[model samples]
Target: MCSGPEADFARSCVSSITSSGQRATLLTADGVRIEAARTPRTPPPAGPAGAPADDLVIVLAHGFTGALERPALRRAAAAFAQRAAVITFSFRGHGCSGGRSTVGDREVEDLAAAVRWARSLGHRRVATVGFSMGGSVVLRHAALYGQGEREGRTGAHADIVVSISAPARWYYRGTASMRRLHWVVTRPTGRLVSRLGLRTRIHDRDWDPVPLSPTDAVPLIAPTPLLVVHGDRDPYFPLDHPRMLMAAADPATTELWIEPGFGHAENAAGPELLGRIGEWVAARG
Candidate 1:
């Protein structure tokens, strides 16, 4: 956790720079236009003894029913921006982005675009922090793109990966929250409610070939540092979810933090925890 003064400085810096984020309209491989905002790293405090400027950039991926301007997302971005530049974007169908959500399938492309944008902005070191549904997308995207760098294929790759409150497998309905989420994705009436209440449009079809699960993607994230954070008290997924992800990840390069009393996603994340996450990413760099 950060001290009172550091926390206040972080909030103040973010408040002043949040509105000045460089707005970007990124087009995914499948032609979806994703609404993204990149808040450049806050300038170091004045004076020779001030903190050094950071070169790494952190890309934040929000969960279902979340947008770039969502309060939780903004708070997380601010915390990260205290240590590095931050990019927050809306997945298709969530905010002002075009196209419907295919849940986690096509969302991988959305993350890819954001990562590319980060690299284009002159930051060679990039890290991704995702929550809930966004968490799963990070895993899959890393597996698909990160591996390409080692295999001589071309694509955007993240230097580090952090997944919070993510599920290891798909089609899980073990919890009431997940059950409700399934209803929202599978039923027309529930979809209507999601559209009207959440402004999220669900794709009417199922995954064609069934995209790889988070567990399947975990093994492929080796060589790139991975962090798995989950809450014991989360209503959406049980302990088994994070456990499965950790088990599949390369133990030598992976870090696992099972918070005792945390809940789910960005909503449950506090400024202190977000500050800690920024520190962890900086340490890796």
Candidate 2:
């Protein structure tokens, strides 16, 4: 790693005002135009032979009802961009993107498209960091790639995966919030919202036409390096969620990092944890 006042600082959404960065619009397979910001490195850093660029691209996905530039995600993007290429995006029906939240089912397509875009850039290793619903989306992508659901990529090419406060298994009972979410989704009113195509929500209070869950598919991503971070005291998914997810992963390559007293998203994530995350991904290469 190199040093400078510049390198000391990461390129976040706020810092983007002074750098070369822009949003990339990709119309997903479903025809909804999901929006993502690409934080580029004017000068990519050097690494070991065949190593990821100094500015490895990290695609960030937000939790329920979050925008591409949510304050927490922005801070994280800035922090990680200090060491890699970081991109953050809003899922459909959330932020400025079209359509409503699909509760991780339909959002998988959006994530898949984003992964494709990252690959198109010729980056040998792309890492995905997702929070909440975004984590669900990332996990789903791993499954799709794991099983060759689409084009058979199984994202076997991706060098790393980072998930924070994600529900490793859906429809689990430990959190009151999770129960509420299930209630909302199973309710008639929630189904109506899904039918109407509403976006800009964290929790989809509606019915999803294709509600394939993460728990049901997480096992498919075996052999791929996995990092599952969670807050032990989180009232949302609880510590057990990540534990369950790791159970399905290869123990040699899987890591479960528990943050004390953290919540369900990126806001509470500390610099130490962020740096640890960077070190983890970097070490994998």
Highest lDDT model number: 1
- Clashes counted in candidate 2 amount to 16
Give the alpha carbon lDDT tens digit for every residue of 99-145 in model 1.
Answer: 78898899999999999988887888889999999999999999999
| Top model number, TM-score | 1
Q: Give candidates' CA RMSD values in order.
A: 7.9, 8.5
Error in Å for residue 25 of model 2:
1.2
Model 2 spans > 4 angstroms off: 1-18, 41-55, 149-157, 179-212
Off by over 4 Å in 1: 1-19, 43-53, 150-155
Query: What's model 1's lDDT at 104?
Result: 87
Q: How would you encode candidate 2's per-residue C-alpha lDDT over 26-141 as one tens digit per residue?
A: 76777777767777643435655544465367888787766775778877877777667777777876655656566777787777777777767665678877888888777777
Candidate 1: residue 176 lDDT (0-100):
89
lDDT for position 166 in model 2: 85
